[model samples]
Target: MKKHFLPLILSFLLFACGNPKETNNEKLTIVTTTSMIADVAKNIGKDSVSVTALMGPGVDPHLYKATQGDLSRLQGADIILYNGLHLEGKMGEVFEKLARIKTVVPVSKGVDPTFLLSDPVFTGSIDPHIWFDVSIWSATIKEVLAIMIETDPDNEAFYEKNAIAYAQELTDLHEWVTNEIASIPYNQRILITAHDAFSYFGRAYGIEVRGLQGISTLSEFGLKDRVDLVNFIVEKQIKAVFVETSVSEKNIKAIIEGCQQKGHNVVIGGRLYSDAMGAEGTAEGTYIGMVKANVNIIVNALK
Candidate 1:
């Protein structure tokens, strides 16, 4: 009887120590759909929350499928965040279902619906790439702060203070980006990439932007796209075309070959972080870092 009692006590202790339920004071466990959202949530949450981004650097969110581990993480998290506006494509359905059970918030849901681009494929649908503009992202950050406060009322003040500080940083970033881009002559500031992810960026920064692929990666690049872009580059004497970190460079390479065939010289400006950020520990790993890297690349390439 004594031996049996001792074993029961050991089991209880192990369960208590190893499987302790997360407390309010303990870090809030947050699962996000993309690295960019994870970065912004980190800034607002600071040390108060532990963030796990399902999509890492160079991952296309539209094509990303949730793994079993990701589902498990989402199931257990105190809060789940996604870009929404269908950025996750098929994954958006999963988040919608999870919303019924837990606090699943779309960080970009607060953006003015008018700011979203209308796409032909989805007819009446808006583009999900709102983070391309810093002003639009300021609104998204506010929503993140509100969600954090709602999840952990005890940390409301802390989250608010951090958010204000971070928002100021974003404000400064926007001004800096505006000034930097203004230095480049308008004609030299065209941005051509693998997809139409930068319409917001171009709209805000005063640049002409084009992409080989449509807003969704589900669409394939066709001959018309190739011919149009190649001819545009040749006719305009466009200096550089950029490639996205997550997308294949094959299409951009073909564009280069086409330009060369026309006796026009074009250079690959640099890789840009579109749907995702750089790897952890790199300058472009965080949201701010990703924007800064893009601004630097665009300024240097165009100037």
Candidate 2:
């Protein structure tokens, strides 16, 4: 079905939708790939732009495909913001077609390539989970700020003020995460999750990290991978391993069972928000809130 949707996007591209920016009274319609990007856009574009996210809570962007309605929304949007670096792995063609006709911004564009972590399994590709590190994620806010201001210069001052405040909030969050993770003794700061999404988090906060699957959930893990992970858990005597909200728990459960067979009682720490944020209107729905929730979960479980 998704293979068929790309051709439909080409057709949608042929028709010109009404440009909301041309009118003075209407607000700009912003469509985002993930809720994390939508939350930031909403905070900065507040009351000035109408923002909508195509992928909601628990939706894995790695495997997510655009729908007919999503194509319609993408066609109608004034600007489209997405986390590039192949995070939205299945929607590359959709973004390419949309880019020719509208303002499509990849928030990760502002991140310094030198600072990016390369994928160990997939050569030449970098990790897309920049949001795990609050400081690094601020780079994305800058990208959004620049794009919003470029598209709507009239609100340049407003956007600048909002971006500054948002940046400071993230700075504080980064500090808090550093201090919180420190509480869990250095030797015990091992964060094992369902996938390699938290490599940035571990690097930024001084914790060792491991994942059953590779960087992207789309990658598969075989029996040997599971056996090695179970052996590592038993050897390290690690307390708990976490499952991601956007990923399947079957893998983690199997790891726990494997640990049990070796007399190591490993528990599921908590469901951490990895590829996606929590449901809308909840604390974890927002990026900052999601970070705080994850930090708290990790600290409580490990400490």
**For residues 1-303, could you state the per-residue lDDT of candidate 1 as single tens digits?**
211322332232211112212364579899999988888789877777899999998899989999999999999999999998888887977887998999999988767676667775668778788888887777777678778878887766667666666777777787788888999997898999998899889888798889999887777877988999999999999989999999999999999999999999999999999989999989899888899999899888877
Distance from true location, Cα of 94 in model 2, Å: 0.5
**Top candidate, metric lDDT:** 2
Model 1: which residue pairs collide? none
Estimate TM-scores for all models. Answer: 0.90, 0.92
Tens-place lDDT digits, model 2, residues 186-245: 889999999999999988889999999999998988999999999999999999999999
Q: In model 1, how large is the Cα lDDT of residue 34?
A: 90
lDDT of 1 at 25: 50
Q: lDDT for model 1, on a 0 to 1 scale?
A: 0.82
Model 2, residue pairs in steric clash:
none
Clashes of each: 0, 0
